[model samples]
Target: MGLLVNDLSVHGQFADLGSFAEAIERLMVIRQISLRFGRTLHCHRSLAHARVTATMTMPQAIQALAFEKRRAFMLWLTQHGPFWEDSRKHGPDDWIECNGSIVTDSAVGEAAWCCLNGIKQSLVSLTPSSWEFSPVPVDWVSNTGDKKSTGVVNHWTPAAIEAALQAEPAPLISWSQLDALAIARCTRLTFAADAFAPLNGLPFVSGAAQRLLFVLETLNRFKSCFDVAGQRTPEGHEIYHDFFTGKKEEGGRGALFSDSSDEEKSKFRSEMTFQHPADNTMSLFCSWHGKVQTPQLRVHFSWPIRADEPVYVVYVGPKITKQ
Candidate 1:
């Protein structure tokens, strides 16, 4: 009854990139979804295209979508898209169609994929189904059991997912990909603020109190470390760099590491080196951090296209350490 593609019935079928594009186009019209304010004048016409133009690549589009909107994209596809329910609409090979390509052929792992070659569908005169997918991420069970989406689609019901959780409401600390962009109407951005609450207020807090805070701090510190006027000691080193994103020094602050669990520090660094080179506003995870962390959370920042939009993200996660 939850999000999973593990039922064997859906084992071989996957929605590739093109299928993703098609579904996104339809969902936009069906749900009256708009990225019109997303990036360009053309967004009023096609949200998918608008996103690609704004980010300049398909992967970037996935990374750039605000967490909620991305959730919408996945929800509408797996739960409510026309072809997902009625196999009749799929191509002869069982793959969903987009510009005559096989979209379902691609591998299905962490995210949803769509195929589109500049197609459009208008829902104004059509009827939609009562069983619709929600605009939130899902965790599913694949054939191997217990597979989690990277929050790429709606409640996956193909038997791959075994549980259900959304980014909305009061969520416990768990691994969510969109943790960085997640929003709460609050006055404090710090983990200890009312929005984050007890987790931050705990008595023994220190060492990157939370993944979100550490992620943000890492970026800020990274920026400061390389700033034009910033200093490099006589030893040709940046202490802030070594402390925030670098390895643990004998005398360094253990507080800089990600302490998902109260007991130990996580090995997860920040993924900035690969994604953001010279770009002032880009974020991701550290290469090693993924191995030791649990209830995963990662946030990537980008240079805002407009003012007052300095830092934004895609939501998802919890910050707990390994056992």
Candidate 2:
């Protein structure tokens, strides 16, 4: 489970990764991936995001990323839509560490935050390379829309994730514990909210049952940039982008539908209608680090998908080398 945000350099709102392909195509790939975030990321994923820098090649940056990431990435690529329901629950303190990220089991709640950060501007590659797919930007984090995460959700366990998979209906909003796990797996944020039930609708508004799905998809996204095993590095490798669809705009949540024909607008409206089920969502700016206020809810804007515009496959990181 994870949160896809706009440009991490400047703070932006949360964005759905539903249109993974179309949005990624427009991302600016540069040398330095920025680690600056609205909240602290898991140490392992933090390590992943920090690997981005202004000077290193994509491959040089994600050198230490593990293969489990690749496995997670592949699983996510094969599926579509929110993955929060499938996120993994863990021991009270299970955590992953990386030079850039420090993530643990207990702290994960609410918004899912997980991604690589701290590089140059969007879509600007530092050194020209021969990689087929260009490096686009994506990050991750965990969050909670309302309640404190208790770790255990509806009796679902880590073992459940590995076995007995059940089909989840379209995401519905509710105050289920899985939502807690989903919030934790996606991104890490400190915010306050009143107790309420999540209404049915929207991408993330649905119950947090998609946690495992988030983990799978995020790992895939994580793997795409890192490509730890050098399976498809530096050239026209399909590994970079296997899970993107132009559906995020189908909903009214994004900025892609601003210019459209009457018929297209109608279709867009028909497709759109889901809003996040929770409300009173606000950004928490903390000052204890002194006093500050954070804009909790925001949308990360990116170039919309255009019928006239052609999409191309591009790699987002340095080429991985065999050890």
Candidate 3:
């Protein structure tokens, strides 16, 4: 998860040393909470030199902090120092495509740029009045030089940080925690109990579980769209194309899907047929497959004729026979 500290909020916002110290404490707590959930706090490199009050820079403020608070703040800075430095390397233009507008060179604009490009966690701010730094829609300029409103960027004060972290989606499940039952339960995708047996014999490959989950999730989403619309929408096809070409990067892993070649399907008809999960007497030709190329993992499933019926995964393992 990505959390960008609004560095501009740190400068000259505090009323006194006491409030500045309190803000530091809040930041430390936020950092600890983020770490517990496997996230890191990032700030622009300029934060190190940011003024805590009109007269005191961050370093000076740190020195003035109470002993225990100073020690903890220093440690947090030390641990995340490199991340802050890295953030400095990229400018707002790097995110223009995603935001479709020019971000101001100011601190809040930098935070907005980060949020637009997948650093979507809340923008952490020092003072309660950091709301002032929240940019209005009018602040953004479109590529054609027309004013456009960027997506709502969430500005999180110290009080709201914990709740925001708790609301984030659950972490990805590991390969060791993955199984056919888990997949079915997590995705609500239906398949026979024996459909996943092939997975038991396949050697474990790095990122296999993640890749498999992506395929299942994509298939489940497509099923949902079909159920709602009775036909695939352009948006649905765009999603399919992204996964089909391994272009969607946010999901667990890259996947490519295709139908079996006619020659291969003809020769391996028996190998591709499996008992339909919805009906024991009926067998379906499970020729459509999603695959991970490096380790050659394949998941074959049937595309049901009826919109109401779910896709039935019939095989999961090595590639089926092909000439």
Candidate 4:
């Protein structure tokens, strides 16, 4: 449930690059869901090829679809084309009739593979050359468990997967492969409004603030332990962690959750570097922020911007630290 394989279940059916692109756009722009337009095409054609072509045109077609209907189309497409194809291959073209049953079966499998390949190619092409400062990036990074599909399909109900592996031509992937690829794409896209645009009225805050707020809210609801704080130096704001309760600075904002009740916090501490100071730290914690529903608060801090990091992340749990 918390891996990339889960994400691909949504996008693997796209027959070609076109539908794949449309699928991404639909999810990113108007809320990620199964779209309506894709379904009519899937139901009418009962095949991935036709579904793919129809999906490719969805961006424009969506303009005509009611905002509410878009999700229906996307969900229908997900439930129909890709799912069915992965479950089992279908009949072949007339030309293949001459070939023996075995050869024809091989042909169908080949077609399915090709369709999946097209989807992979399309997704890679659609990747933003670079991301601007946004809350959630479109693709998932390994740090956050978001994996891209490199033709490795790992999710085939255990029994089905076992069967596919035993089949001829040594299958390269399973249904689960699509899940990871899809999540990878999602992780890459940032969900935050483009810089200054918050859906409601407000300053829209800063990326750091938004991220810290998410962490605090999650811990509060779940009753998990965490520490967070920001410090101003002659250089800039340093938003480092104190791990366990340590000697407090003469003047400092204690970690978000630490209180007088807990005199000594754990000694273990760590730092999470972002792709950019502007990229913020929260995106690194949750694969995507907006996807989570909680409070609307942000953490403000001054830190050196690091672009080379490209979402660098580190984790340190409860551990004893010396002074």
Candidate 5:
């Protein structure tokens, strides 16, 4: 059984004030990861919107995946974590300390506040008696009217999130008991856009972009596959359906598609597809006090199939010895 947030909070009651403070300290890890996620998501979406007619390169897809992976972490934090408002009302100097160092960055502080707000917001979607956050409506599609859109929906209205906070509903997870689950795992997943070659472009767009769009569209098709309803289909058979059929313009089948040259098609199957398992790995990394660390405890973006690795990979860190 999972440790309920309420119980975890109560556990703090048995410890000294120092431990209580220490418990809150670890929350920085969660907060930092959420901030990165939000920033990346915001940046990528903005870029993709601007480059609407252009082909999405591997670099763009990697960044987009990075953003999504981060957003998911933020969702996890808000849906499951304990947060307390900072008592300090003044400048950065008046702040909490973890491991004898003062926490001063506005970035970290801003992320903490956003995370707390997210937690309050989540209660709006839950039934009072239910311990878990409410599941998203599977069939709920946005009214944006774009046929290929599968962007996330805003489930809780602002007023509802506010009401839940005002009532002081139970938290998703209390201080001191946050898991290394997905968060920790995401920190270790390696992401490199340059790992792939520049897949050839089609006359219309590029064969690369088409394949990428195909995977993105199909990823959400089986979202409800593992639901409470225990309907059984053939093993690995779910990969094929409306998304893959030649009838759909987006599907890769017999559409007016054939990116590879006739000469190329006869020689090699140039493009490939990727599928990630349910419990795949996705990790993010950073450095603290000059040592490399996976502070946020999250996994790498789930790896795409062989045919569509990201286009460009960006590396940020201090110099290190090559092994």
Candidate 6:
């Protein structure tokens, strides 16, 4: 995901130069968190030249900072390459229809541009008196004259960005992309180094990767609950059943699944068993699975028994059965 620093958000009064510099520190913290989740931060190409206060441009304000602070800020700017030039190529001027209302606020225009361009905005609010750049909901008209809400240009404060780090990830279009990104993209879950290899030979289905992600997320929630309250909760299978049945909502999402029967598990124990990556100990009889049918796909995983451990995925491929 890309987080664009709203240049408009910085064009306001601050209590002091210190306060403005503090906001820059907050922005840097936000950048660190964003980078942890494989997200990039961006600023408009014109932001460096834009006036942050009545008399100071963004570069001027940075220059006014103490020597060490100025050097650090300059280093960060060079590394992140904040300035983005493609935003103007999208014809941002035509995004918001006038509808007989003259819309002249550059901030609102930029917000509309972000909305149309599928970019998230980060505000540089320095003080309590700073103006809130609220989300702008725009109606987009299709060539057929159908009007539809094209989503709002929502901006995140530093706190909001941190809060959203664990939210459900956006779906990917291919299994290869999902396999490459599953661990980083799914913040709450972990994967075995060999887990994705089996999936490489399998054919891709339209929504199989997304369904697999949902299942993984649900399992992550189950593991989290078990870690916090393992003694009081039911066994792993029972809790897993509740999650898939929608009976439990503590990070649960209803999806399709069933535990392998005792006969099947006994017959295919070797097939179901896998070497644990961390300890190289065998994780036996990973019978719990989430299934996607028609083409028939299955994700086989084991629940964590220890505290602070993640739900471990062992296999993702065609459903294994005794032929």
Please name the candidate that would achieve the greatest lDDT relative to the true structure.
Answer: 3
Whole-structure CA lDDT of model 6 = 0.57
- Candidate closer to the true structure by TM-score (higher is better), 3 or 5: 3
What is the lDDT for 193 in model 2?
A: 31
Q: What is the TM-score (0 to 1) of candidate 5?
A: 0.20
Off by over 4 Å in 3: 1-4, 35-46, 51-56, 80-93, 97-120, 132-159, 164-173, 178-182, 185-216, 227-230, 234-323
Instruction: List the candidate 2 regions with Cα displacement exceeding 4 Å.
Output: 1-175, 188-212, 215-240, 245-265, 268-323
Best to worst by lDDT, what's the order? 3, 6, 1, 4, 5, 2
Q: TM-score of predicted model 6?
A: 0.44
Instruction: List TM-score per model, in order.
Output: 0.19, 0.19, 0.51, 0.17, 0.20, 0.44
Candidate 1 steric clashes: 55
Lowest lDDT block of 10, candidate 1 = 114-123
Per-residue lDDT of model 1, residues 148-233, tens digit only: 23233333231211122222222223322222333332112222112233233233211112334444544343433332444433
Question: Which candidate comes out best when scored by TM-score?
Answer: 3
lDDT of 4 at 106: 31
Per-candidate RMSD, Å: 20.7, 24.6, 8.3, 21.6, 21.9, 14.1
Candidate 5: Cα lDDT at 192: 42
By TM-score rank, best first, the candidates go: 3, 6, 5, 1, 2, 4
lDDT per residue for candidate 4 within 282-318, as digits (tens), equals 4332111111112232221111223222221121111
Winner of 4 and 5 under lDDT: 4
Give per-candidate clash totals: 55, 113, 0, 44, 31, 0
Residue 30 of model 5 has an lDDT of 29
Poorest lDDT segment (10 consecutive residues) of candidate 2: 286-295
Q: Write the per-residue lDDT of candidate 3 for residues 1-323, one digit (tens) a residue.
A: 35667665675777777888777777777777777876667766566678778788888878768898787667656554535444342244432322334445544565544333223434666664444454433243333343323443444555466676687765544443456434655464676677667767566643455556666666766666553658777766765665454322322233357677798889999999988888889988888897754456678887642366677777777778744
Off by over 4 Å in 5: 1-133, 140-195, 199-233, 249-323
